[model samples]
Target: MTLKPARGLAVLLCVLSPLAFAQADAVRKPDPNTRVPQGVIHHAATGFPDRIVASPLQAGDAGFAVSWRTSPAVDAPMLEIVVAGDSPDMGTPRQVSSRTQALQTENGDARYHHAVIDGLQADTLYAWRVQGDRTWSAWYHTRTAPAAGAPLTLLYFGDTQNQNTSLTTRVIREAMRHAPDARLALYAGDLVSGGDGEDDNEWAEWFEANDPLTTSMVVAPAPGNHEYFEEFEDTPMERRVLGAHWPLQFALPANGVDEAKETTYWFDYQDVRVAVIDGTSALDLGTAEAQARWLDGVLSGNPRRWSIVLTHQPFHSPRAGRDNVLMREHLLPVIKRHGVDLVLQGHDHTYARRGADAAPTPVFVVSVVGAKQYRLSEQARATMRPVGEDTQLFQVLRFDGGRMRYEARTATGRLYDAFELIDEADGKRLVEVTEGRIDERRCDREATLKGRKDRCWE
Candidate 1:
């Protein structure tokens, strides 16, 4: 498959090379050592649901969607939810029917089940569990989104594709610890390194990294290029396909373009509306116009006070020679017209916060939370100052009535950058709040040498 080069960037099409294709195929192969031993009597053995996650199906959290995995033995799966009380016992559990699918995985065959619990009370704490055959998972508690005008904080992560089980795990745990009250965790795509998205061990490690968090906090994810895979018959790759596990693993809203249904959707939390787009499909396939049309409608009908867009590729590339010109040309106009407050992105391994130069509509930010590091490009330095090269970082964003505060922290919980966006009657203002923060991390010779020793400065 040959992708048309984005404007002024011929290297973007190099991803179709045989070497890159081979490397992608190799990365998707499951590691034998990481696979679960056959006949092991684990939680997945008795149909105990795992990888449990919750998402909003409607605005104001009137409805919630949940998905999980169970053993093959448990064909008929169900979800039981109840309003939590002081006691350990759930009183009068409301049972919801679930749709189940049989999936053939590298480890073995398993059933993925999903159910949407609707008519949930706003701001109410509910305890829920999944039942398969005679086994049931432990009850987990989750709070629905509060009414509009409620203040909330959210955790954002970028490109946790490498070292997902080890380094990524630590970063997520630390971010969660720092913001325990975070209502939702948003991943800017590339959740795993597997290009085909079928590597069982890589998926396992990713789930393990999120262990108990998925059961409680809501997860909003986008698909990166790595989340897609291409299959070849003889020599050259033929068609690009989404990861096999994507649809089965995530139960997102279906309010998106037909080409990218669940992968591209929008949801409203409090006063903010978040629209997720499929950048990979837009760039590789011919779905840019379709997504752009859908995005225009979504933005035009927006009733929320603040609107945000999340995508795998940045509208403005942080690297010198790399830029998603097609994405910018197709989607940036819609974002600007809608007066989006923020645009969160990943796929660039460096850290950059742009749009501070008198941009009133949206603030663009690119960040990373995994070990993969890239040097800041000359274009990035010229366009986006206060950039972090060879750094692993995460962002915590808080949303109030008319103010949004953002803080970027390193792996060790050090403050790297800070800013706030205040919306006034005139327009939005970006306030630099990085007082007493450390200086920007540049890729100097000493840091490059240390990076070779696995000690890159954050």
Candidate 2:
């Protein structure tokens, strides 16, 4: 089967056109006086379908959702689908009209369309595309979750925020190269550093970086702090709100807390139940208790064999003088009572992994995929074994009958860290897969008193 790069033509036109550049300049020319000015709209929406992404459904069901963008909110777009076939036509396809929403940005106006398909047979692969703007997107493959107790693979990324199209893009593609059949791409927030009005280009870079992968695998994203900004900035009534592009870019499950619908949601695939918590909204924007209540109800009644928590902030703070204490106070108890197996987090640009303390304890992980890196603190190093600093990495996790295997690889796809969580009779036991791992990468320490410091130290 040909792996056509879906919407490649439209993305190129959006990224490289001179007219798009002129429009970007007209919309948001950065102020030279400001420290970090707004960026131009490099990946403006063309008349064609672009930024196509597939997301997962909730309730442990076997289906997926597709979303895409058009320049001026076309109401006639259709999300066409069929069981994936050998030829390009994808056999005889069935169609459903996409629900459309008008989205306005500083760059201009565009249309966002989404469609949800569920109740299909399990362990099935399907081909789908969006038709609008007098053109059809390239056919792409998406799959339902494998049968229960089957081997399921997923890719987890932390903060693909800055320099995504250039630097973070490779790691993402490398992940697909390593595990091409990965069922989903799960993000622990900060997928793009800019959801603010002036940062539309960053979202474009993100779409371009994910590219073909975004169209294929189901995307499960939680909102990080960067996904929000003040509505009326520098004003008396300014209030922090989720990004406008968020709802338009991805259509996630609305089964979370009523106030923070898609941002705080839960879904199940095979044996694992994944809960996406909006720590940014919970702690920063006064929805902590509501999400906590929702989280408690969801996790307490979770029907899956295992539960994994995906969120922006960590329960255990790694950096000194930085703790999400309020969020932890509200949500950690529920996590413990419910015995969530793994907690995936981002926002610490450094990578740190902390194993469970005892039986039913959750294993915590924080990683970064962006080019930007930070120093791993001494406390983090002490608490979290196998910590890393100034490194960019992506992780591929696989779950089989009784074991969950995780491998963290570099941009070049070399094995840097590995682990296994074995489901025992009592609880899941943590096992570090250490044989093939390369030496732990870290900045050198100062030994001689006047010696030139390593670049990371500086």
Candidate 3:
């Protein structure tokens, strides 16, 4: 097929080339096994397919969901899938058509396409590619979520809003270095700096920065406050509404409240139930009550072995004068009653993780991986433990049945913290595995000694 890149590793290397050059000002030795094929577009642009992402469906879903974008929409965007080891160009690869959603942004009109690929065997590896502008993208490898007994791992990030292209790519690359075969890339929120209307450039940068990973790892993004844009601006009363790019950019399962469609949705990926809440819409808009009700139902009787809540703003705010009280009041009860395992969140511009040794409450994690940095407020310094400031971070988690191993790492691939949780027959036990982790990351005396341009902390 015209789309086939020999092993798909060359395109991956090509995508990471910019970051690699940024690191060493030189090209690293290419892998002897990789080959660059023709028709590979190295950067995101009009008429070329970019910003591709995959997401989960039902628990043990036989298939998965993928979304991509292009300018000048193709007449019929298609998906081609083949068994991992099979010749990609040989037999007729299973074909599926995509539904296109056209979006007009500051840059121009871009077409977003969504496709559902199903009827595949469970726990099987597949390489797939998308057709855009009559051109096919590089092959990306993804596997069907394994049945209940299979192993699963996920890479989680807090935010990649500011400096997404340069700095954020470092953390994402480091994350992939640690968990190359991770099944899911979970974002706590603020995936982009949508403080203004959706900037196609930002989305393009986001996808490019993590392109190699997104096409394979698949993303489950939560909506942070930054995801909401001021709609109807210049009116008597301008209101912030959820950015249109969200629902169009991602074809999430429509299992959330009617008020919060793609933003507040949940799905089962292997043995984990991933519930993403739109705290931005809930607190700023009017979806609190509806979402709260829907979340209760979603989590109350969930049958998955593990349940994780992905929200933008964290309830237990480590920063002083910041608390998502409305969200906590509405959703914490449901989480507690359901015995949710982990709550991954972002938007605080810092890192803080709070866990309970004896209590059954969920372990709440607030982290940020972007260039933006914030100091630990007095509330955090006085209360929360395992706090990190002035450092970009990422988390990789491994799940084998009822036990989970978690690691939090820095932008340069240093282990910052490590922990594990085991859901025993009696109850859940939390263990801190901090042997190899570096000391807690905090600003130094120079930070406080520096001027405003490099002020240490807020």
Candidate 4:
């Protein structure tokens, strides 16, 4: 197979350069000592062939759900949850209960499967695993939400499309290095390249890229523009492939808008209410009325101290001059009234941060982890306090007591930017990080010239 570099990682064809490819292929084989294969793709054994994933881990609470896939579409994958206490002799977790249900793929593949493991104890570490007929995955452990009022921590990532398997892994692994047990992970969308309309391999590369972290971590994903596939009623290939794979891989809260478009939903953690909206549906298709209504309900009804909104498009764009002004026109007021703390997004393929102000000035961020590059927009430079044109980065947000600190770091652990969002109910204070010299250009309209100029004051 001939392969080309997308984001930044050099793609190696399985057949190209026979000697090198052969050596690389030799490493992907399942090892007796390793938990997962290095290179070969592994079909989730416990759930559908697509996903053997754990998600919706109740934040600041002690409960979570484990969803997986099974071949031949079994009734349910066996779930074993064991709470680890002080005693080292807890041995292995015994079988608790199971759910038998059919997972229907949006594209009409009935072979899909799903199950939720609920009602586990709180603030405790639990060892669990999924089991199918001929395949039983190795046991893994997860820490539930600390407590209802306890401070929470999460990792935020924007776009990881394009050269996913190569550059994406570095950023993800770096985030874990900063905080391995981050309670939650947020995505601004465009998790994969080759838009939902075509480029099936990008999806595979995406799954392959994040397999290291997602297999054990809980991630909340919102759809980005690239996730949308242009298709008429007659042939919706993108929806079929991406849709079938998304639900199969990640188990999200089934609770969402009655009339909202697909995969748009909301779920609450201890003191936080997180809502994910399908921006593409709302912006391009004009079919997100139900979603808008649902957002209203979630925000109006939510009683959490913090409400964070996730979408693929950014409200305060550093690029495209906030091209999604239509989206802002509709949802901005709702967010303003509801007191949303953070607005996470992707699509710009760069890193940006704005001051947190009381006038519904939510901290809008656009960071990309993939290898794709884009010129920094003039508006982004003029508006955002800090914007990077050529950096691959991820962010870590830690909520410890009354103070919330957000740190953005490069794949190599250099601090790119930082901010503090205090929950005074009044607003968060702005703290600029000047650890590194940011003497880089603000905007390079000719995508090729981005980051090649110097404009920052020394």
Per candidate, the number of residue pairs that clash is: 0, 0, 0, 11
Error of 3 at 360 (Å): 4.6
- List model 3 lDDT by residue over 77-173, tens digit each: 8989888775546456899999987777766677889998878888888888998776898888888888886889899999888657767888888
* TM-score, per-candidate, Cα-based: 0.86, 0.86, 0.86, 0.77
Tens digit of lDDT per residue, candidate 2, span 354-374?
866665358888988886566
Ranking by lDDT: 1, 2, 3, 4
Residue clash pairs of candidate 3: none
Model 1, 1-458: lDDT tens digits are: 66565742566545477666545544553323223455442333335667778876757468588888878887758899999999986689999999888777656788889998989888888899888668788888888887888888888888888667667778888898888888788899988877533366667778887766787778889999878887673557677789777888888988989988858999898888989999999988878888999999998978888888999998888866677878888888888878888899998888998883457558898999876677677788888857897777888999999899999898878888888889899988888896867889865433322334222322
Off by over 4 Å in 4: 1-51, 57-62, 73-75, 85-111, 195-201, 233-242, 356-360, 425-427, 436-458
lDDT of each: 0.80, 0.79, 0.79, 0.66
Off by over 4 Å in 1: 1-46, 196-198, 233-237, 356-358, 444-458
